[model samples]
Target: MSFAADSPFKSISILYRKSHIWLNEGCIPCDLTAAQAIVIMIVCDFSTLTQDEITKRLSLDKSVIAKTVTKLEERGFLQRTTNPKDKRTYDIHPTEKAWQVYPHIREQVEACFCRMTQTMSEEDRQNFRRLLDTAARAALNQEE
Candidate 1:
């Protein structure tokens, strides 16, 4: 249940925080939080996606995403409007602000990610990413 100082998980966690902090600090002039940035990225790739859609995409629960999306909507970053085709469902739509900021934010984040990945061998990197995706899918497919 615990990790030593040099464990991969611990190092990765610290690196995650470092990268997140850098992203937040770099992306200014936008009323965006890192969480909101994540939502925007997901919605961009999966437009008109619903709360359940985001939850499934991010492997998070609906209530948590609902709360985050509510804040994003209130801040004018995203809109969780009712799906006109199916009023019973709602979908996430990005605002102009989100569209404008996405490219820069994604670039910065990708640069940081590249910096991290540079340490990995090409084969190991591909395998690691695939395995991570597999694990994520398995976790997401589990019963709620």
Candidate 2:
């Protein structure tokens, strides 16, 4: 019933951005850039996604993704292998180091978020997720 401007999306987004400072600090155990974190998170959740597939899911700028993937590969976190079915395309696979770090990263991110929301009830969390999704669509899917 309300417009995107009327939603609490801004507050939620700001909160996430602020909390993600931990991700940006150079001291994080992951030793990863924000872009690397993004790539790692995506692959951790959905194993064996193509670069193009990641592009669509993230809607991130192609250049940023390319730089991030290159850095990650150079840092020994992942690698690009030719797609068996499509010679022109490449698939990303996490390295042993990436496999080892991913579980820890997932745990840390979850713990950070869980600690932040310790007071919220289950129903409230569910409602917030639904509202957030609706608000995100409204905000991001604006017509020209």
Candidate 3:
């Protein structure tokens, strides 16, 4: 069979799509879609963050983050209280339920990475990770 020419964009696109599918399936037990699971993981890591903080960190649209946060709050995975320092903004925090599923969410994330790099040697994995980080930073126009 003929192979397609090497293209980083094509490879990255495929990886992004496939990883999302894999993560979504893995998160099924937690009753979360991939997006919700990701929001939970971020909130759990920070303990408390404003919706704007989450949006900036994830580089997602504000409306999307707002909707996700609302859904998470309704489902008991998160709690939102008016930020004391800024009454107009809400501070998002993971609930006991979110903590309960934190490990599983982390496991799914780790498993996805492991599967993605399973074929690579340890050194190759390290190099690939480093290169990917650099590329990401460049794409974001961030200083190294």
Q: By the lDDT metric, which is better: model 1 or model 3?
A: 3
Tens-digit lDDT track of model 1 for 25-98:
65654656666677888887666688888888887777889999989888887887788889999878988877
Q: What is the alpha-carbon lDDT of model 3 when measured against the actual structure? A: 0.90
CA lDDT for candidate 1: 0.77
Per TM-score, the best of the predicted structures is 3
Candidate lDDT values, in order:
0.77, 0.73, 0.90
> How displaced is residue 102 in candidate 2, in Å?
0.7
Question: Which parts of model 2 have CA positions greater than 4 angstroms off?
Answer: 1-9, 25-27, 130-144
Worst 10 residues of 3 by lDDT: 1-10
TM-score of 1: 0.77
Colliding pairs, model 1: none
Winner on lDDT (1 vs 2)? 1
Please say which candidate is ahead in TM-score: 1 or 3.
3
Clashes of 2: 0
Model 3 spans with C-alpha error above 4 angstroms = 1-5, 141-144
